[model samples]
Target: MDLDRASSELNEKLSAIGGTANVAVLKSVVTQASSAIPVMPLYIAMVFKKMREEGVHEGCMEQIYRMFSQRLYKADGTAPEVDDQNRLRLDDWELRDDIQQHCRDLWPQITSENLKELTDYQEYKDEFLSLFGFGIEGIDYEADVNPNVAFDVIDI
Candidate 1:
């Protein structure tokens, strides 16, 4: 069977289990499996767009800050919250019902022509480029730099 069919069957099986939570898990799995599947990239793009519109989009720095300040080192010394499986739920915001529902509602309406109009593909591309320091601000990509520059290592 083709990937889309397999994905559809998986959705059917998950739906048979009868829970929105299970669907959410399926969506997460699909998003993570984007490398192997074709449609998942589009799904991820839509999800990211929805997240940005909701004002809950977070980059690596923001997520790390939350993990450190809220989870790892709380001022009250309380233990970090975990799910039933004893896993940190740092992705709680992205897995929210409203966000997922918005993506679900928009998924069917997306097409190659409407991709930019319906999704945050441009922002996604920019963020992906920024990972390699390409689109960052205040940096001269054309400037020459010494490859062996040494810096002090401070251990805390």
Candidate 2:
């Protein structure tokens, strides 16, 4: 992966917002992509739109919570799995009103922005590569996986 190209793309988009993006941050975002390509632009759009609507801006913890919660999100885009049972287990209490409102506000914008930016198959493939750790930092994937390792519980 050409980090220089990825870094340039990340800075270019951030520059439009009068902000600076560092390599570490870029690498983190790039690593999250499903493809090896830098997906910062898509992230920027998603984050900006979500911040506008959600009112409750999320840090990493909130991000993980929402993402994990939405893994079973419905086909109609509703929080199908975040029921009382889930809320009680996941949070200290039941599904709080504030949480519902936040999701209601942000989900639409997140969905719309992602749909808009990631509709292309080429882009999808690139994004997927990054998701699987292809474009991330501190990972020299050029060294091949040890094919000799096996699922065997003991030496045969």
Best by lDDT: 1
Off by over 4 Å in 2: 1-90, 112-137, 149-156
Query: 45-102 in candidate 1: lDDT tens per residue?
Result: 7887787889887766677688778866798988666565434567887889999899
- The digit string of per-residue lDDT tens for model 2 on 1-156 reads 465466567768988886533322111222343223565455433443344354544434665565456433335655334332222123211124654454455445555436654333234335557656566658887887877866758766
The C-alpha RMSD in Å for every predicted model, in order, reads 11.6, 21.1
- After superposing candidate 1 on the true structure, give the runs of residues whose Cα lies further than 4 Å from its correct spot: 1-37, 132-156
